[model samples]
Target: MDATFPRARKNQLGYKTSEVEEFLQRARRAYDGRPLPDDAPLDSERIRLTAFGMQKGGYSTAHVDAAMERLEDAFAFQERQIASRLHGDEAWLSEARTTAQVVANRLARPEGQRFDRVSRLALGYNVREVDRFADRLTRYFRDGWPIAIDDVRGVVFSAQRGGYRESQVDLVLDAVVDVMLAVR
Candidate 1:
């Protein structure tokens, strides 16, 4: 079914209307099993990492982002399913395992050491705090530390100089979670 989303009122700061609509149209087509254009990009990674422009009186950003995250999950699940069918279960699991190992290896490093720090001119998540959380995540991956997906989704960090890059951290988290879910 095609989902209808609520739009922001005039003067509200939200995501760009046209971009959301265009992307949602293609998302609907994919979800609804209709053929999409040849140029359409539906990869979960692409959707997860995409940035949207903000506009006044457009779609609410929080709402759009939530919806897109759901869409990305759906696509990722479907990707796993397709891969299983195409490559057989063992092969798919093998690939997912490799990806998970890579994530685990990276997370094993000290949080601040894992990703490049953002320029001082541009603010990002506080290095010390993110590294602390990264410690938790590393434990989770390395020693089966008791943390849930909610923890990953709910992470917040303070601003600091030369902090962990926001986009990089987010992308890595997304990738790790995607692999975990796919393999599970």
Candidate 2:
């Protein structure tokens, strides 16, 4: 019940303290191999997608986000260990490689055409920004360029009418994260 994270500045909004605390408790339990009743066991993917409501005085967003990244890494490591143990290292690695290949193929598409666009009147992620990010991802996978998981996780694109479809771009980014975590 003690404050799990520092509050935001007096006037700035941050994640709702109660929600963050509850989710952290659940994550902790899951990390310790004790999932709550009727709740699906937590995993790295779930942790990556977790969000909290905001309030005027609540847990600092940066602090909570850093904690989430660490938690996600821990869970990913645990999952990798378990999978390797059950399926053998070769199989586990093969799966990761396959996933990487799939992501690579998506990124291989030409710029501006990599993902579907929204309807003319609708808004989506900026095509140019996404293409630029995708270029970085391609280098990371193909040329051994260094790119942090946070870089991929924190990327934000401007919205444009008839821009690249948001869901499609998001899914690709998620897959890229999965591939990175699997090999890490």
Candidate 3:
């Protein structure tokens, strides 16, 4: 798989290895329990450890493997979807910024022509792009909390619903923020 999606910016999640490691840690913890121990060699190694853990009990290795596989698949799918959405939003935002700059440049033109075509185009572009970004951010705030690097939404939701420690909410929120800032 391509390491970087959307843009090659350092802040973008797919482009940053550290955050990806953190995501895998969170996901593994969500799948099993507790963040993958610090001792684990790496994120990929830790995931392998979790998969290894599935075999410890003599129950059904096949079933355990299947469950782990499902969790991994779900995490990848959700991450990609979220990243793609953020990428689209960032692209639009950049376009809006460019449009604004162009209009500002044109403002230096003779005063009579100041309110002409370029100004209108810039205003329209700003409204469209800004509205899109605002809408997307609102949606993100509404939906972002539940999705985490660890694919632990179920755990977070159930814990919150059952009134466990509220910190889990913070953890999820932080992870979401990481994804947002990192992906953008």
Model 3 stretches with alpha carbons more than 4 Å out: 1-50, 53-57, 89-184
lDDT of 1 by residue, 92-133 (tens): 788777877887787777546888888888888888887787
lDDT by candidate, in order shown: 0.76, 0.92, 0.38
Task: Compose the digit string of candidate 3's lDDT tens values, residues 36-149.
Answer: 456343232233335332112123444434444455455544545555687865664454455434433433334333222223323222223223332333344444533333
Best by lDDT: 2
Q: Model 3 scores what on Cα lDDT?
A: 0.38
Candidate 1 segments whose C-alpha is farther than 4 A from its true place: 1-3, 32-38, 118-122, 146-150
Q: What's model 2's TM-score?
A: 0.95
Clashes of each: 0, 0, 2
- Model 1 TM-score on a 0 to 1 scale: 0.81
- Order of quality (lDDT): 2, 1, 3
- The model with the greater lDDT, 1 or 2, is 2
- By TM-score, the best candidate is 2
For 1-184, candidate 2 gives per-residue lDDT tens digits of 5688899887999999889988988888898988879767789999988999999988899999999999999999999999999998888789889989998999999898999999989999999999999999999999989999899999999999999999999989989889889888
TM-score of each: 0.81, 0.95, 0.24
